[model samples]
Target: MTPATIPSRFGLACVLGSALLLSACAEKQVILPGERESVRPEADLSESRIRLDGNTARAIQLPAQRVNAEWTQGIGSPAFRVDHAALGGQLQHLWEVPIGNPDSRRARITASPVVGGGLVYTLDSGAQVSAVTPEGAVAWSTNLTPASERAIDSTGGGLAYANGTVYISSGFGLLSALDARTGELRWRQKLEANGSGMPLVRDGVVYVVAGDHTGWAVDAGNGRVLWQIMGAPSVTTVLGSGAPATSSDLVVFGFGSGDLVAAFRQGGMRHWAEAVAGNRLGRAVSRISDVTGAPVIAGDRIFAGSHSGRLAAFDLHGGEELWLARQGALGPVWPAGDSVFAVTDLNQLARFDASNGSPIWAADLPGFVNDKPRKRGETWAHYGPILAGGRIITASNDGLLRFFSPESGQLVGQVEVPGGATTEPVVANRTLYVVSSDGKLHAYR
Candidate 1:
C-alpha cells in the first residue's frame, strides 16, 4: 500500500497478461440499452450568445390587441412604441405597386412606409415620395431630389404624414412639406448637413436628426427651423438613420456616435446626454457605435439601443439609467406590456423584461445566405418585431415574413415576401404594409 510500491493500474494490467493488455490500456465507450452509435450534433455556428433568463421567462405578458387607425410616423408614432396592434386575420397579400427606385449599393430605401390621410406613403432610394391609395393605385408621386444633388447621392432620409401634409427629409440636406392630397410642395428648407432619419411630427413641430449629428426641431407647417442642437460627432457609423422619439415635454434624439440626448420640446435646451456605447469583444461591427434604432419613450421611461451592444432604459425626467442589457438592437425596440422585443445583432428575435432588462427568450432567425454557415456566403438581415394580432411579426431580407408566438418563441406561421422587405412593415387600419427592396409597396389584409 506504500505510495511508491503501488504500481499504476496500466502497469499492473500490462504485466498481468498480453491477452488482457489491449482491453485494459485502451479507452472505453459506454453504450446504454437501445442506443446506437452516431456522430455528435453539429454546433450551431449562427447561434446568439444571449440566452433566456429562466426566472422571467414565464412572466412575460402582452397587452390585448387593439386596432390602430393610422401609422403616421416611420417608428409607428412620435413616442416610438406601439402596443399590440390588431391585424384581423392571417395576412393575405392584397396588392403591390411600384413605389420608386429599388435598393442599390449607393442608394437604399431606408424609410418605412407611413400610412395616413387614407393613403400609404413611401420614400424610395432616389429621394422620391409616392402616395398610394388603399386600392393599390398611385395617388401622387413627388421627386424630392434637389437639382444640385445627384439622384444616387440622395439616398437617406424618411417620410412622415400629419394633418394635411407629408413631411420629408432628404439625404441632400432638405426638409420639405408637401400637400398630402396633391403632392404639391408647400415649402422646403435647407439644412447644413444631410437629413438622416424620419421626421417626427407632433403638435405642429417636426423633430429629426441629421448626418452631421445635429438634431432639428422645425415648424411642421412651413418647414421652418425652430431649434437645433449638435451631438457628438462620429467618424464611422451605420448606413441608415435613427428617428427621434418625443414625449410631452422632451424630445429624444439618437446620434450616429451612440449619443442619446434629450431636449426640451419647446426650446431645444439640452436636458441630459448619455452614450449607448459598449462593444462586444471580437465583433468588428460592434465598434461602429451607431444608434441605428430610434429611442422609444414608453410611459415615464425611455428605452434605446445601439449597434455597440447596449440596450438601456432611462428615466424620462432626469436621464438616469434604469436598466441596461448588452444586446445590440438591429432595429427599433418594441415595448409591449411587461416585455420589450427587439431584433438583436445576431439576427435573433429576443424578448426582455421591461422592468429589469432580464432576457425572457430568444428565437433564432435566418442569419446566413440560405441559412448556411457564414463562410458559405453573405448574411441576411431581419427587421421588425412588431406586435400585431397577438403575434410577433418580423420581415427578413431572405424574403420571408415570420410570425411567432408572444408567449413562446415558436414560429407559428410564415409568408413568403416577394423581392424581400427592405424596411420594417407598418400596420394601420387592420392592414399590414411593407416596402420591398425592389421599390414596391405591398399591402396585406
Candidate 2:
C-alpha cells in the first residue's frame, strides 16, 4: 500500500518490501486466541512514521462532569478505569508527608496509594502499611512483617479497601485484613510468595494476582481461599502487573504472556481467552509481550495494551475482538464517556474513540529514556500518566506534576513535587494525591 492511501493517523505504509505497520491496516485485522505463534512480523514498527493523522483526528469528547467519590483501590475500584473526576481549588501542592522508605538500587515503589472512608492508605518498604487523614494527619500504622525479619521483597504487593476493612497482599506471600481506621490486624493468611500485583475486593471476595500470574479469590472477611487459577509466566516480561478488573459477575486480567482472559467472579470458570501480543521478534528490547497496563472494563467493552505493541478493544458481552491499535502502551487506559486516553510507549499521549480504534489526537511527552549509563543490573523507571478532572495528570521522573488539556493535549499546568512519582497519581473526593518515590504522600486540592 502507498502512503497516500494509508490513513493519516501515522502515515502507515506496508509496500511489501518497503515498510510495514499493524496500524496501517485498511480494516479490522482480527487476531485470534491461537494466532500468537503464527503471526510473524517481517518488520517491526521501529521505523514507522508517527504523526497526527489529519483525516482521522476528531474533537476529543472527555466527560468533564464525572466525579469520583472515592479511590478505593490501585486503579479506582475494580474495573481499573474511572470516568471524569471533580477537582477543586488550584493544582497546587497542599501538603507532603513521608510514608515509609525511599527508593533505592535494591528496592523501589511500584504500587499506587488508595483512599476510602475519609482516610488514605499507603504501603512502604519493609512491608509497612499506614493510614492518614485527608488533612495529612497520621491515624495509625502497622507492619505486615512476621516475627523473624527477613528482608521483604516487593512489600507493597497490593492494597484494597472494602466493607470497613483494609486488605493487603504482600511480597512474602501473605494476605492480611486490617481495620481501616485503627490499622489493627484482624487476620492473616499465607498464600504464595512474590505476590507483586495489587489486590481488589468486590462482592465479598478479595482478588489477587501473584507475581507468577496466578489468580486467586479469597473470602473477604475471613481470608479463606475460595478459588484459584494459574497461568504460565512468560520467558521475558515486565517488572510489575495490574490488578484484576472486575464488573458484575465477570473478572478479567492480562498475563505476562500477552494473554487476556475473562473468567467468572463466583466460580473461576473461564469464559474466554485471547492473545493480545504482536510479533516483536526483531530486537531484544521489543521481545516483551507483557500486558503491564491494567485492562479497562467499561460498559460492554474491554480495553487493554501491551509492551510488545498492541492496543486492543474487545466486546465484553460476547468475548469477541473489536479492534486493535499498533501503538504500544505501558500505563492504564483512561476511559471517559466516549474517549480513551493512554500513554503510548512511543512517548506520545493519544486519544481514541471508544467505539472504534480511530485516532482522535496525539501529543509528545518525554518518555522513560535514561541518558545515564548503567553499570550492571539497573531497574527501569517511568513517569506514570493519569486522567484527572478532564486533564492528563502526569508525575514524571523529573519531579514535575504537569496537567494537560484533554481536548488538545496541550500543557496547561505544572508544579514540582519533592520527589518524582513512579506510580500513577490517584484522585478521590475532589482531591488529588500523589505518592513520591521518597515515601512522601502529597495532596493537592
Candidate 3:
C-alpha cells in the first residue's frame, strides 16, 4: 500500500472518529462431558417468528443459508431464513473460570476468549495469558510484564491459534510463538513496550499492533520480525485492540491516532497509508486507546470504523478511498452476513450498508438517557458486537447484553449481565460466554 501524504479530513473524521476511536472502546469456557453441564442450548427448539422485545426471547426462521444482501438504505425484509426465536431465554450455564484477581479489575479478562480445537485462550488483568479446556482446566498460564504501568487497560488483545501454534503479545513488548497443545514457548521477539494488540495470522505471518503506534508482521514459525511500520492503533483500551484485515496480499490496519493503512503481509512493506485524523486530544487518551476499530476485510473493500465516529471503505488492493460516513461517536463495526453493525459511543447501534458506506437501520439502546453513560465516560457498544446463530449480541456501558435480529436491526431480547459486560460475548458450541466487570463469568445458551 502506497502511503498518502495528503490526509483527507472527512475521511479522517469518519474513519478515525467513528470507525476507530469512538466505536473501539471497548469471554469463557466450555462444559465438561458430565459434572453438571453449566448451560445447555434452548430446549423449546422449533420454528418461530422473532419477537423484538425485552420480555420475549424469540427467534426468526429464515432459510438454512443466508446470502449477502445488496446495499440498501433500510433493513429490508429478510431474503433469507432466520431462527431468531431459537435464541430463547432457556439459557443453560456452562463452565466458569476466574482468570484475574477479584480486587484488581485492571487485570481483568477483557479479551474475549478464542475457542478453537477444544481450547480457549484468554488474557487476564494481571497480564497473565492462559489456555484452558472447556471444563475450566488450565492447560497453561504465563505472566507477562507490561512495558508500562497502565498497560493493563480495560482489555487485552488476545492470542491467535493456528497451525499447532499459539501466538500472543504481551504489554511489555514481547511476542511469543508457543506450542498450541502445550503452551510451551517456541520463540519470542521484542517490540515497543506496553504493546498488547491481538495478532492476526494469515498463511504463516502474524500481524499485531504495538503501543508505540506501529504495526508489525512477524514470522509465525520462528518469531522473526518480518516488518514493522507506523500504522493505526485501532482502539483506546489499555491492552489495545483491533485485528488487521487482510485482502489477497494486503493487510489493513488503523493507527492509534493518525490514519488507516494497508501493508503487504509477506514483506514488511507498505501498500497504502491514508491519514484519517489529527491528534487533537494529545497522546494521553490516544495512547490509552487510539484507533480501536478493526479493519473488517470484506470482499474487494476494507471496512473500518474509528473512535472519532467516522467510517470509511477503502479499496483493498490499491488502498484508495472509496466512501466515508460520519456517525458522531466512537465504536467498532460488527459485520453480520452482508450488513455491518456500527455502535456509537452512547450505546446506539446503527446498521450500515456493507458494500458501500451508507446508513441502513439504527436504534438507540436505553441506558444512556440518565446521562450516567456519559458521566461515567463509558462508550456504548464499547466492546465489539457478536454476530452468531442469526442474532447480534451486544452490550452497553451500563451493563446490559441484548440480542437483535441481524436482518432488521430490531432489539430482540436482553438480559442483565449484573456487573456490566465490558468484554465481547463469545459464542461457541451453541453457548454464550460472557465476562462481566464485576468479576463474574456467565454462560447462556
Of the candidates shown, which would achieve the greatest lDDT relative to the real structure?
A: 1
TM-score of 1: 0.86
Per-residue lDDT, model 3, residue 102, is 32
Tell me the spans in candidate 1 whose CA falls farther than 4 Å from its real position.
1-60, 76-82, 370-377
Q: For this target, which candidate reaches the highest TM-score against the unseen true structure?
A: 1
lDDT for 176 in candidate 2 is: 90
Which of the two, 1 or 3, has more TM-score? 1
Model 2: CA > 4 A from native: 1-57, 64-67, 76-82, 281-283, 368-384
Cα misplacement distance, residue 276 of candidate 1 (Å):
0.8
**How well is each residue in 206-246 modelled by candidate 2, as lDDT tens digits?**
88777677788889989899998776678665654777888
| Native-referenced Cα lDDT, model 3 | 0.59
Over the stretch 158-184, how does candidate 1's per-residue lDDT look in tens digits? 888889899988888888999999999
Off by over 4 Å in 3: 1-90, 102-109, 146-155, 232-239, 278-289, 328-332, 366-381, 439-441
Q: Arrange candidates by lDDT, descending.
A: 1, 2, 3
Cα RMSD of all models vs. native, in order, equals: 10.3, 15.4, 21.2
Q: How many residue pairs clash in each candidate?
A: 0, 3, 68
How displaced is residue 379 in candidate 2, in Å? Answer: 10
Q: Mind giving the per-residue lDDT tens digits that candidate 3 earns over 1-445?
A: 3357446655776676676564556423566685654374453321121111222222333334332211110011121112121343445555566665332544545455566556666666545667766666778876555445454452454566677777777655778777767767788888765556767777788878777777888887898888888854444433456566666667776666646777777775787787444221321333333455566665576666555546677777887878776542244466555566766533467766676766666666653234553474433444646565566768654677777776667777776776667566665555566666654456666
